[model samples]
Target: MSHATTSIAAEQDGPADIALSEFFDGHPVATFAIDTAHVVTHWNRACEQLLGWTKADMVGTANHWQAFYPRPRPLLADVIIAGAAGLESELERLYPGKHRRSALIPDAYEVEEFFPNIGASGHWLHFTAAPLRDGNGRVVGAIETLRDVTERRVAENALRRAHDNLEHVVDKRTGQLADINAKLQEDIAQRLLAEAELRRSNLELTELNQQLSRAQQQLLQADKLASIGQLAAGVAHEINNPIGYIFSNFRTLQNYLDQLFGMLDAYQRAEPSLAAPDAATLRALRERIDLDFLRQDIPTLMAESGEGIVRVRHIVQDLKDFSRVDANQEWVWADLHRGIDSTLNIVSNEVKYKADVVKEYGAIPDIQCLPLQINQVVMNLIVNAAHAIGDERGRITVRTGRDGDDHVWLEIGDNGSGIAPETVSRIFDPFFTTKAIGKGTGLGLSLAYGIVQKHSGRIDVDTALGQGTRFRVRLPIRHGAATEDPTA
Candidate 1:
């Protein structure tokens, strides 16, 4: 051949030799090259080792379809044709027949079959294919490769299943936790509401207790006033008896004096000449009339009238001391005995009918208190004791003493039908009375409690049904002094 023809032929031959040499390298993948006529142009050392074939057996082979795959790979043929006609294509493929003559594959290959190829010595093969193109971007042939990827595929499928199961378990646990949290929040809300209700109930009870205390004070005051009114009526009757006699004697004396004046006037008119009587004659007439007796008797009468007026003044003073309308006034040192005596006098009428008072006075110090209010309290307690006895005569005991520390105590007890357990608790409330409607206003004990509280004192009672009742009042010895009364 000429030199130019020799160079051109050498270049063509060089590339084919290089391509074949590169395919013969001991790579793991089975590689092959095919021509546009679908004939095998080259086969690698890997293909020969995996498929039990050599380059001598597969090269220049027109059966490229049956040689590269254990079965004819139909999808590979389609992809090659389309790409040769200028289209893009991609696909995945599984290996054909099973190794060791397993029943998974047939001897003759088919397009749809995935079978492993087993050589005589029991080697397994896996296959995949792709189309090849020339520099002009036109598909000219195809290249196929194969591998042993059985272990890898199995492991990947197991891993995917495990991940899906784990996800499902996590979702279920999250749903359960959300339910538990919602229930816990609802329980907490219910407990809070219950606690709030309990607090409100306690507040209501406290308010009711305060109201009861106030009502008791009002009842005590009313009882006291009723007793005082009854006493005043008795005292009025007592004083009226003595006053009636004194007035009758004065009227009789005035009549006698009027008669004597008439006689003297008649004498003066009858004897005009003797109208201006001599001093000696006038003196003799005065002597006969007993001027010294008239003077002595008139002075005695004036003195008796003054004594009656003093008695009335004493009664008035006692009444004023017993009634205490100014209970809010400040405290002062007060004689406990004097207060008890005044209260007893005020309620004497009530007790006289059904009870007798027994005094047991002690040498107690003056108690700091509102005197009039304290007296009113005593009056209420004493009178209530008498009323409790009804028609039966009972003994009412009034006692005074000093307690430990700076306090004075007065106790009034009666031998009468006592209070019931249920009734005793509410005995001091306003308008709480066992007496008939017209006879009691029920403010006595209630007012007494209020007065004691104002003085920072306390009043307590002990009683049993059918065993009589005892009321005890404890007052401070010294307290804030009372201010001067503006009305005084």
Candidate 2:
């Protein structure tokens, strides 16, 4: 009914503008709004519940920052207002990092900042704000929504510190090994001590490496689950579109059936008439109910309902195939194109908003590998490609084909902001990212690297600042067939 009634109402009586524009309470996210004067005008229940400040205390005041700041610093909404009013330099002076325009929301800005007074130590708040416009299209105020991502931030920091420790070990052990070699050639007495130290270092390195691997894999799994949770909303919306129309169609069909049954009862009652039911009576009944229109529209409604069902089914299957819900990550000969297509479908929401995806697929044979793991790699590449493109209209080209007789290659290329030359080397390094806090875990490409390595393959990047970046993932036609290729 929502689908049908909305369209019908739209066609009959176009939408009306309302003056009471602020709807903070209706928003699912914790939200608050302020007027052009920077006075809080709308403070929602969620906001009050999250921030321990009620609407009565907030609404009509400019003391919003005191809730989350030590000395009333400008919040994300204030930064957006400053930027809108051409005070962008003030934004730079205030928030040097951790704040920027959100790629997901137009004309809105997002910031991830920690406020120590919010929780035990601090809570990382990810918030987005956009200028609110009145019915006359006048800039009235700005509204912001907030969410706490404290656990993820804590885990990320721990992982970063762990990575630093691992790096320190590498540096220390390299120097120790070089010294041990020099000393073993010169001094025989300390050889035992040096060998024992080397053994201890090796054991420590192994342990630290194991810890790093586990942290990275856990991060990858967490990221994957987060992706799925995000995808669930998009999938539900996609399914709802068809279901809504199908329901409307069914209602119309039910009405048609009622009218048809009424006409049949009329004919039966009039059967006992003098001339076996006068044609005029039945014709009048048909005309009253617009029987001719029903005859023309009923078949269309049924056909359209069938199409809607098929669409819903296809979306469901795509979700299942992308997740590999019942399938294990086992090696099998699979069509790489199929996996790419399914992964693309699953992440369509992420890309459709940022860039237009272009597939330049070539003839490729079935490759023997873990399909689900490869799909995960493809998903990460495509999502990263979309994010790289940012909010502007851009293109993401995915190309695939044989890389020689021994390897099959897949490349995801984006015509967006390219990576810096210096940053390219660390793009695949664990815990290294250019994304803002709460936006990435920095383990996506590293996980992809590990997956490729496990398949006896390699992932290489070609990037130039301002010219775009292309990630090429090449896998052996048969797993372990590439001689001397390292595995993770």
Candidate 3:
């Protein structure tokens, strides 16, 4: 070989060896070489930085198994020995002391049980060892590389824990929400049922109210008929008294006329001359039978008959007034006092035994109303007040006055045994009364209530069991005016 050829070969050899050493030293992982005696031979800068050891301190001096893995050092022995026999194995080893060191190393080393020595605060390392072969393919030593995987493993564990916790929380919250939704559904169902029941109850109540109204109307009609019957009986009794005497007077007159006719027939049967003489006898007979008394008694009988006719006419008029058949005939401004007086006259029979009436009439405006209907209402109330006294000779005070704007007020008060608290609430209800069955019809107050309401008015009662009762009725001054009266 020439000098130039030798120089060229020498230059190529020098750079190639330097390049190999530089590549090994500058690697990002810890690099080391183990000898056949299972001892560390070479250590790179990455190894020094990772393990806190210098190459001169650990190389050729100690085995990695004795220094790093104190307990169970054979755990790495099997892995490395197996790799030397062309088998693959991986070993994990944990170091004692603070910042426990953990490592994973794959083995295919020339010597058995050979690993790198690491230090405290060292990152977790994953290492792979490959058996170094000579040109003849004979095992010589091993080169191992280690990488830091501590941060990745720690982050993966943290992420896994967080994921697990989130799943657990989601499952718990989902169960709670389902329970709440079920409760809400139950509450909604109960509310719907309650509303349906309320609607049903209201419908039933409306039907009951309609039935009660119809019953009330029937009761009122029955009561009016009863009153009419009583009045008819009274009128019949009154008429019979006068009629009996008038009929007796007519029979007496007929007997007197029969005696006179018999005397006249006797005169006709006598002889004509003797008849002239019998005239004196006839005059004596007439005088003795009292013809003048008969003539005077006949006029008295006619007068008695005329008086009976007048009484009947008056009774018929009272009946017409009580019935109010002509109530809607016309509207007229009427004196309320006069109507009240008339009502007092009609019910005088009711109160005569139990109560006395006193009137306190104030200057009031003439109210436009149906006089007959108002009279009926007043009479009913007066009679009720009398009956309430119950033979106590109580006093009833009837008063009239102008109330507030556009209203007229009438007050009828009784100094009688008043209403009981329990009965007061139902006093105006139809068929409710404190009196005995034959003495009272129970429709008096109810009819009065209806009549007052028809006139756009209200009736209020103030009573206490020993404190007497006062009933105040408020009516509009004008026919169609609104009423401002509080009754409850």
lDDT, candidate 3, equals 0.68
* Residue 63 alpha-carbon offset, candidate 2, angstroms: 47
Question: Residue 120 error for model 3, in Å?
Answer: 99
Give the per-residue lDDT of model 1 (tens digit) for 178-208.
9998887879978799989999999999999
My TM-score estimates for the predictions, one after another, are 0.42, 0.51, 0.43
**Clashes in candidate 1: how many?**
22
Instruction: For model 1, give the 10-residue run with minimal summed lDDT.
Output: 105-114
Q: Write candidate 3's Cα lDDT for 87-183 as tens digits.
A: 3323333212211112443334222222334454434565556665557965555677666777786797799999999999999999999999888
Off by more than 4 A, model 1: 1-191, 194-205, 208-307, 324-328, 436-441, 480-488
Each model's lDDT: 0.66, 0.78, 0.68
Q: Give per-residue CA lDDT, model 2, range 117-199, as digits (tens).
A: 88567788898889877579766668889997888999999999999999999999999999988877788768878899999
Residue 294 lDDT, candidate 3, scale 0-100? 67
Report how far off residue 427 is in candidate 3 (Å): 1.7
Backbone clashes in model 3, listed as residue pairs: none
Higher TM-score: candidate 1 or 2? Answer: 2
